[model samples]
Target: MFEDGQVVPRAVLDSLLCDAAISRYIFGPDSQLINIGRTERIYPDELRRAIIARDTHCQYPGCTAPPRLCEAHHTKHWGRDHGTTDATTGVLLCWHHHIHVHTHDIDITWKTHPTETSTEKHGKRSRKNAPTGHWEFTDRNGNLIQ
Candidate 1:
């Protein structure tokens, strides 16, 4: 199907559906429209805003796209995997990266802050500052992406 005069591929549709307000259309065996209604948003406005604030840029590794160019993506697919639409399960990604992930079957997971220990000259243990959180990206073949 076409949207905004552009051809939308299945991968793009899958990416969009990750964080879109969906509507359901049911059809009958005779090709008659049986029911139509809007469904709950995958990523509501407030949750999406929170994710944007948290990420502030594309979450795809090495990507620098700003939040304005990003879209909220589910770490797990909502349709295929019955993933929950929660802030903890979502990340911001640019349009290109979003489609790339779906097309390439990339998996994303969040890692909490980890303490890094260092030994001082006197053999005392010290903690080093580290990122509050990090994300891991892997391909369908189980290869990690930097």
Candidate 2:
């Protein structure tokens, strides 16, 4: 159902529907990304809750802002690039990291391990290579942060 770089994961959508967090939405003829109208929030309330549950701290390598304080950032840049607003497409980042990412020279990539090595035992999504609560942040010159 997805390639490595695709947005709007089927697993996250299934989870949302199965949990009754959000129902079906009707899109208009306009081709613009649908905004659910939560004032300025890009991610939905339920989606945000799901993210907080998975990411207890900032997903950025060394930051430790608690889930609630961290902002749910679209890895693909939601509004500007029409990034999807699902679990696989989103990550929590502290204000500092968030600002730095938006304004600095860094690349945040979701790195998933092979399914055989996945520690998650829940039978639902197979997650095998899902977000896994870790992300790879690299500099413009391709140096991974340690």
Candidate 2 wrong stretches, greater than 4 Å: 1-41, 115-133
> TM-score, each model?
0.67, 0.58
Candidate 2, position 1, lDDT: 39
lDDT of 2 by residue, 1-146 (tens): 34776786543443332222222332346632333432233566666776787787898777888976777776765444445556666678876677666665466778876544445456654534543436888887899986
Q: Positional deviation of 59 in candidate 2, in angstroms?
A: 1.3
lDDT string for model 1 (60-138, tens) is 9899999889887878687667666667778999989988999998999998886676667776777786666888899
RMSD of 1: 11.1
The superposed Cα distance between candidate 1 and the true structure at residue 37, in angstroms, equals 18
TM-score of 2: 0.58
Score candidate 1 by TM-score against the native. 0.67
- For residue 45, model 1's alpha carbon misses the true position, in angstroms, by 2.1
